[model samples]
Target chain A: MGLVPRVVVDVMPKPEILDPQGKAVLGALPRLGFSGVTEVRQGKRFELQVEGEVTEAVLADVHRMAEMLLSNPVIENFEVRVEETA
Target chain B: MGLVPRVVVDVMPKPEILDPQGKAVLGALPRLGFSGVTEVRQGKRFELQVEGEVTEAVLADVHRMAEMLLSNPVIENFEVRVEETA
Candidate 1:
């Protein structure tokens, strides 16, 4: 067996897009009997499982992928968290 | 005007799903003379912009929304980071 590396990617609105979904859901909140919510916007997330030993070098390569291929720096930012399974 | 709150949502692989897209991209690496990458997986990310004063209480409502509608608990998880803009 080998150690697996996983990376979590989070993407969000740039604060420019009119969040209709967020608003629609927010408007429905009171009807749902949940009046606590005031405003809502939704985001997307990604999970990746990698192979090989967990090392900073390995992670850097993954980070490069996130920056280059996986995530867009213009409207999104991402952080990588490695899971333990040895 | 009020401070706008934003949450960055990241979703990724469960480590169980066979990541074909990730693999296809990885397999193409060597052709580009980039032999470093061996395996890869893809994921989705979301960005949300919220309205109102950014406070712990306000964020609590937003957090609850994430748990309720924005994300799935099984095979998925989320984290909240509020942006500051006054």
Candidate 2:
């Protein structure tokens, strides 16, 4: 087996949507003595090791997967980053 | 009110720990026609907008926060990236 393709998918809630987890963190920052922390947004990151080259086709497939399963398009947005692991 | 610092905190389960979410994603990939997806690791990313400069002291404080509140040291590892939002 050769080196695999690595991809990172960052999925975050849309700015207009309310992020309760982020809000909770923001609320607790000051209590934790992290007063400088003004805002916080919690999100998901998926590191995918694909069994192939990091070609355009692979990147497209990954993007499709991110949209279809990794995130909810209505209230969230996602970014796909293709890395050269080989 | 100068430029603020943007910090991205990434928290992921240690390699030895069980990641049921990642496993579920890996298992579903093939069925979803994503045969090339060999492995998947799901993690959390915290995007924090700090109300100060991205100084060394600020980075250190962020690291402390990550170790104490952002992640469970026994089960996961975390990374912190300091960015300029100026």
Candidate 3:
């Protein structure tokens, strides 16, 4: 089972939620001379390696995991993208 | 003063930092049939519109802000790139 599986999951807090980290970072732009940057939202990207054909079951499971465990459903939304063999 | 400056700030936690969120997402890959990706480190990308010429001084200020305020240097490293007028 040397098959290497990779997955990229990108998740971000919804616009309504207050992302202190993102806000603090966004605010610092002008003071640092990055004057025109606006609307900075922080997110997550994940890459993984797995085994088996890319099936709906696998995608569903990953999505479920993201919604129920990996990310906070109340404030964060996640997207899971799967890729096989690099 | 309608010049637009776009800045992409990509920052990531140093390898040593334990990213639970990233790890959880990485772990879910096999369950999702994504079996080729490895070493997924999360980072930030900032796009901004600012006013002024791309000068060394501007770059320096952005760099300093990223290090001192925007990003947590103890756990994060960032790169500031500036583009003027779209």
Index of the highest-DockQ prediction: 2
- Give lDDT tens digits, candidate 1, residues B1-86: 55555555544555665657667667765554444454565654444454445578766765676677655666545566766546
Sort by DockQ, top down from the best? 2, 1, 3
What's the TM for model 3? Answer: 0.54
- Worst lDDT 10-window in candidate 2 chain A: A1-10
TM-score of chain A of each: 0.65, 0.89, 0.78
Q: After superposition, how far is residue A47 of candidate 1 from its true place, in Å?
A: 1.4
Interface RMSD of each: 4.4, 0.7, 4.4
lDDT of 3 at A69: 54
What DockQ does candidate 2 have relative to the true complex? Answer: 0.85
Best by lDDT: 2
Q: Please, what are the lDDT tens digits per residue for candidate 1 over residues A1-86?
A: 56555555554555666667667777776665555444555544444455556568767766776677665768655667775546
Top candidate (TM-score): 2
